[model samples]
Target: MTAAPHRPPGAPTADGTEIEGRLDEAVRAVRAPDAVFALSQDGRRTVRCGGTAPPPPVPRDRLRYELGSASKPYTGLLLAELVRSGVVCGADPAVVHLGPGRPHPRRSAITLTHLITHTSGLPPLPRDFYRQGLPHWSTNPYAGYPAERVVRAFLRSRPAHRPGTRWRYSNFGASVLGHALAAATATPWEELLTERILEPLGLAATALAPAGRPDTDATGHRADGTTPVPPLLIGGFQAAGAVRATPHDLLSFLEAHLRPDGTPLDGALRTVQRPVLRRGLGHRHVHTLTWFRHPTDHGPMYFHAGATSGQQAFLGFRPDTATALAAVSTRRHTGRDAFVATAYGLLASLPPLDRE
Candidate 1:
């Protein structure tokens, strides 16, 4: 790992050239066809783009990138907003909104809190996920599993462990939470998210994939970084991994989390960052309602990342420095993919800038 770049004291922010250099370096390291990097610090924001992909006629900043499971935080925020509005509570059982008489395996034991926190003891995907997804596993694994199927599976499937007794990252749990929230509010999952989180945060460019603005969306690539892949169409797992946004909008979302004093979601923003559970050996790591939390010498850092069939994205921020970052690439993530590592290293090593 390289040392954090030293910023000259009193420097307002990293200049454009410096930011461009960082972006270009990562683009080369990962050999991404298209990449964008956005930074927000102490009310100042900058975005840089570099890659070999043929630039669209429109400005690069206008292009949207898929944000796989990174969308979970937004779902978490929606839950918090609903809770603050008294439409639902974290302690409420999943069955409360999952339609009565379905007879969930966990019944009242699996609460919304458990679902969002990844402690619901649910598996990573539905039992039939492989059976249904195998045909289109590479292109669109979740295409066939509709919301109705997901809910039904949950009611009939048995949990390996008791609710809230384990810490397993479950896409299935996230999907169920989205549907439950929708049921409680009597709205569709997309509408509930748009009304509660996206609209309030002014994330106009952020929307579920395959439905975003077509004119300027970024084309995703296979691991080869050349072959194009269709947009991922996650039927029922929308909450688990279906969000996308331009680099600018993604950065804006993280900035709101860093500094959310008077915003409509101030309370909810703070709520998502509160430590909700501890996992890992000796419980050394931390997880908030929405984000993965890690302590640093400067302060705590919150971050989430995601990957689709042909694209990958990372979102993170350091509250102490009022620094937030959004990184996106057209190439899919692989074991050797340096996109995630480079993006994360950049965030972890950003100089603690002036918070004024």
Candidate 2:
């Protein structure tokens, strides 16, 4: 459905041609306001697509997109590094770092592992978050959240289920973990990530919270695709859902996860992808750090998808084939499904690995 391509549709490239074609048609198929995609295979070889149609690609490396909860894996990777350095262990309860006082054991029993895997039984958000944040739905929802308030919320609330008992996505849990990691290191979360993960990995373009570089950021589209949505700042809970980066930055990140050599965090990267919890019926899939394992005809894929108020992002890698893909779109709600389908379709188009 894309504005007709001059090249024959689905022309061959080193990257899967059929998938690339679908990637093009998909944008027109769903009529996205704007989107970008990147794929990597065999560690270094990379292919990227931008624009609503195909040719005259936008600058993939400089056009920034809000990563949303796609940022969680970065946090997970940092936790993996801390584990390697013996700075913190996943099994250790998160309360070890909360300051000013200790929380009651019943309320503070959640561990770093529980937080990373979404098994802490905390709700998708803290109860107070929406109560206080809804007024800012069109502005910065988390503009005023602070460390003291976060600790107070944890200490005062009761877990929906016992820690590590069941899976429930919790932005609150991740924020707590991020805060704890920051405290243990005696550095702010953004600075801690920069020194330990972003800098060491050489990902200079990735932007966490408190970083405002509008010159490079993309404009988000609302459901109608007419009015533009302003940039969102995740404030104190940034580690849970606020990260912005270019498609090129994500391509480098995917390569690091699949092939960790020549990188400083090789061991931690490998560990971050290992499955820890068998979730869902028949245990057909597992949760690894912040990644989700879903069955596909080719094999099991470990991936994560994120949505902010105005943006959507999908990042996935076939662990068996070491093929990775990242797709980001400027619109949210229905637009999310558009490119999510594009990304998964691309993955399905990948030829299965030839096992000896």
In model 2, pairs of residues that clash are none
Candidates in order, TM-scores: namely 0.92, 0.87
**lDDT of prediction 1:** 0.84
Clashes of each: 0, 0
Residues 4-71 of candidate 2 have per-residue lDDT tens digits of 11223343334456545655665455555677766666554444445442322346446678888888
Among residues 3 or more apart in sequence or in different chains, the pairs in candidate 1 whose N, CA or C atoms overlap within 3 Å are: none
Task: Report lDDT (CA) for all predictions.
Answer: 0.84, 0.74
- In candidate 1, how many Å is residue 270 off? 0.7
Q: What TM-score does structure 2 among the candidates reach?
A: 0.87
**Number of the top lDDT candidate:** 1
